[model samples]
Target: MPQDDPWDAEASQHVARNPGRPKAGFYGAVPEDDEDGRHPSSDEDEEEEFEEIEVVPVRPKLSVAIGGFAALLAVAVALGAQTTGPDARLSYAIVLFGVQLLGLLAWTMALHPPAAGATAAIVALTALAADYLAVTGEPARFLPLIWVALGGFVAAMIGQFIRAEDRQRARDSWRSTLLIVLGAVAYAILLVLVRQPLGAQTILVCCTGAGLALLVARLTDAVFPKPRIAAQVPRGATGVVLGAMLGTLACAMLGSYLVLPFTPAKGAVLGLVAAVAANLIDLAVNFGEAGRRLAGEAPTFWLARHMQGPLGGLALTAAAAYALTHLYLS
Candidate 1:
């Protein structure tokens, strides 16, 4: 039988290199990380590997559990709100404060910005002050949370001057501070909401929507975190939109039974605001983490990183709840 193709050329192509002394390193070569012994691949194998590997999204069990926890907090918020008769805001305050501390921890750890300790301290103190103002001040005073946030901003700036040595850190510290401090103080809005005539009911309705939105989004992401918002951020657009719709539906149902100002239509509008705010903020945290990771920063603890997303979302929802309730009721 005749050979299909000649092997001589292929065999010739496999010829060994001529024996020679190895070339010396260039004088212009960079010295940084030289001792690490890893050389840049000309073939770009890592990028190919990244493209080939599938993203492992959040586990269904974990998503369900996290969502369940958010729902549980919703229950707690309702219970605390109802318990707000004489001298009982303390119970709700306790609950809100505990959550604020948790958010503080998660934000501080995930951000790891300069003057982190100072940022945490300022946020904690401001949260305490804001809660006190909300609890003791005249009913429907929206000024307290604002004032506390302003103070936090000032303190955060001072902290930057004192502790931010890196120019990059000086730029980033402000963002970290605002996220942590503002998030902590916004919880006071609920206290203000509780002071209204139908405030507790409002709390119930709003939290139901907000919590359900987060819950649904999480569970949805676990099952179908596809059409992902971004490759690095493992959340799906499907989950976010579906979560918002369902959350609005839940609030509308609650509002139908509750009262006049909180009619189903009104409640649905509020739910839309809260739900969108909640999901977006949660998604924002993931985007931030992705940014840091891609920039070669140290990875945050897995749990803390995940925990911050929900906590930030809920925190922002407080302001949304206050603004919307006041718009409809007042």
Candidate 2:
């Protein structure tokens, strides 16, 4: 059989065939030749489309290492506070301020800065509170706890404000500031209520509960992705609040059983009530902070990180100190 003539087939096809057109091949269509027989326009278009992406700078490894070392040194100083004798107040002040500084440093250096700093501060304060409680072997008081919380709030705010970027400072809006103030007042009221009934023990129970809640919330986040919520609401706020409430209740029950020697059933009831009160305060403050941060108007304050965590720890410290002082006096 004779092979079909390509020229005859091309003549039969009505599609106008240009001699200059590139031939179709098994691979695919080929680029059309320009007047110059080169795809110069394509090359130029490609050049025009090229873009440079901006790379964000991260903190240097050396700087992060130095920050970690400094935090460790601050912890050592805080540990020395336990042996300060009559100068216990001064020592306590040192520990409190040192912890705040360490927190800030951790925030700047750690991969998950906020979590790193918050965890470090919580662990340090909790350990200190436990040691003091163990040494005193007595119930804690209220006034000292209140004072410490106030002092820590003031100190942390000042330190953070000083270090905050000028842009952050300028972005503070009146609405956010008002929210922060209201949150603080609400927290203060809650503290007074809990103190009236539970005394300084409220500090220990609340701090431990909040810490455990944070840990649980972290685990939950790892397991389940967070849902998108309104801008006013922070991600994971609901879960964290719920976790905090349950943790607070459990901690309170355990603490009461061990310290107050209450029956397990009675302790559980008290714990439940106390946890409700604590959760109310925590929920309000967290909601306020979340709104402020989302608005880009968060105050450069320690409480801005999480109102309950550091404040709770400081209150516990005050309670521990009061217990130790009373033990020494009696």
> lDDT for each of the candidates?
0.80, 0.40
TM-score of candidate 1 against the unseen true structure: 0.80
**Model 1 regions more than 4 Å off:** 1-56, 164-168
The global Cα lDDT (0 to 1) of model 1 is 0.80
Candidate No. with top TM-score: 1
* Model 2 Cα shift for residue 233 (angstroms): 4.3
Worst 10 residues of 1 by lDDT: 15-24
Which ten residues in a row are the worst by lDDT in model 2? 106-115
Top candidate when judged by lDDT against the true structure: 1
Task: Judge candidate 2 against the unseen true structure and give its global Cα lDDT, from 0 to 1.
Answer: 0.40
Clashes of 2: 0
Candidate 2's C-alpha runs over 4 A off are: 1-89, 99-200, 225-234, 261-330
